[model samples]
Target: MDKQLLERVTQPLGHPSTSSSTTTGDTPGVNEPRRDYETGTGPSPQQRDAINQIFALLRYNYHNQFTKAFPDLEAVKTGKRLWLNLLAEYPADVLLKAAERAVKECTWLPNVHEIIVRCDLASSLGVPDSWNAYLEACRAPTPKREQRWSHPIVYLAGKASDWFFLANNIEEVAYPVYERNYAILLRRLLAGEALDLPMEKGLPDHVEHPLPRQEQQQRLRDLIADFDHPGRS
Candidate 1:
């Protein structure tokens, strides 16, 4: 990496050594200037340093003509602040990978948003490619009794019930309504009524329940009927 670019990137954040140093005085020390990274109960010193290094590398590469467009020092500082805010949610390695990808693919110097978009894409690449693969991956390694209810369908059903209750403002009779709707949805899901078109090509195209609208309506009707006749099956 070019030394000039490193200096430029580090100068705004007061350089890593100065930022991390314990010594304090009139001179520029770690404690002298409060940075966006240092404010508001942020990452540990090590994490802060790692994020700085990532910014330095990105800025260095951009200034070195790896990207056709380069951001000025102030723009880089502002962008770094935005990136640091995301560190709590996204892993540093993932963000680094995102930065690397942006640098490789984009002709212009990528902003924080562009890097974040790449991070989402990179993170999604780890997901199982097909629904079957996803189900297999979701299976618990240890066969615990509680793990039986940990299936994806159960989770989705719970979400669906919560959504329905909220959407319909069913506060007074939340429990029975939620239970009925959840069971109905779960039944449909188990009966192969929740599948979608295979997202990836070459996978089986004729999976049952290419769309779930019909099943959803049927289950909804069952829920409504249960509500209408509270004591009836």
Candidate 2:
């Protein structure tokens, strides 16, 4: 990740008192995270301005470079700044940890577990764009202050691989997403199939996001127990 990108990743986690007025559900966007970053919790006015500017830059970059549906950092908390240093500081671990937090404390939402497991797999497999594309399209969940659950984000770690994450209500319609996309990318790369994601964006090969396979469900539960609710273990 670029130094600038990581710099703009985090923000002080807050609730309805000072959050975006646009969101409705648990879908992820710019909101204060619930982490225990002392530095992130509160900051001086000068520091706040610097953080906000970074967020603005990130939002602009994310919208312009990625799809239009993607929300920028500004959409998080409107008044407070975040601790994005954590992103560059501990990118993958932080995300996984956040998921864990939601799992343990959050009143169960199967969809939440689904996104976490997907991200875990994507991180393990290294595929972020797949998740990004889907998130850019998925409707933002409602009940704003609730725990953030981004199905598209979980697997953003796997941008370099040949997988694109996708979601459908039925299981029977899953594998084809992964298989077809992988095949197309491979064919295109072998002999220019019209579109080939540039190498600069990591690697090119978009498979579908990990389906809610038995392993995913099981592992996600485990992630919640282990990372978020340690007491449960």
Candidate 3:
């Protein structure tokens, strides 16, 4: 392997590291700056690092295949750049997960499309994608146990992850938890485990009604009078 070539290809184009370490004297959690990847605008430093690591692993694991695929070192560099562009939209963790999948599943040097498809957690698995599942989890009507879920996995994940937390937190904080839970349940389902969603309880056989408007108003006045004079008849 040409270490020089690897260094050149993996180096960040121009952006400085956006790591928390770069922030001096700033309180750890109070007002930390948001990195590019947090808002999903572009590839973050972490994404860059993760992809670079993926390339390193691929080069090591598929040296002969990589040499055959790329005619020269320059071709290898071009291929890496192309991959960076193609995968820049994904989060760092997603990229790493996809690369891990490719390493395990592909018999040869996997193509960019293979990695991208792996990154797509929902479409590849035939389940509702994590993003849509997240929306469903967040926006489902209250009494969530009874709402019609897109998939049983979605409901199970949301319930396991805490419906209240999923509903209240921002996507950055909440989606990952939901996504992880969803993935775990998905794995179990794929392994033939049956996930039972909570059964919606039936309405009672009998129920009470509130008093009519006139009677309710009369009752309210009587209560007020009683409060004003406790012994009044």
Q: Write the per-residue lDDT of candidate 3 for residues 74-169, one digit (tens) a residue.
A: 565566557767886565556777788899999899999999998777345546755567777778898887887878888888988998898778
Per-residue lDDT of candidate 1, residues 1-233 (tens digit): 45675466455343334343332222333242322331223333333544677666665666654223334555455555556666544544455566677778888666767877866763353321112222332343433223433344433443455544434553324433443444454334434465222233476767775558988899989999999999895
Q: Flag clash pairs in model 3.
A: none
For lDDT, candidate 1 versus 2, the one ahead is 1
Q: What would the TM-scores of all predictions be?
A: 0.36, 0.17, 0.52
Superposed Cα deviation of residue 61, candidate 2 (Å): 3.1
lDDT of 1 at 57: 69
**Where is model 3 more than 4 Å wrong at Cα?**
2-53, 67-81, 84-105, 116-125, 186-233
Per-prediction backbone clash count: 0, 36, 0
Ranking by lDDT: 3, 1, 2
The predicted structure with the larger TM-score, 1 or 3, is: 3
| Model 2 lDDT per residue over 120-221, tens place | 543453333322333333333432223243332322222322223334432224322432343334323323234322323455487677776998999988
For model 3, the local distance difference test gives 0.69
Q: Rank the candidates by TM-score, best first.
A: 3, 1, 2
**Candidate 1 Cα deviation (angstroms), residue 107:** 1.3
Cα shift from native, residue 72, model 3 (Å): 9.1
Candidates in order have lDDT scores of 0.48, 0.36, 0.69
**lDDT for 95 (candidate 2):** 38
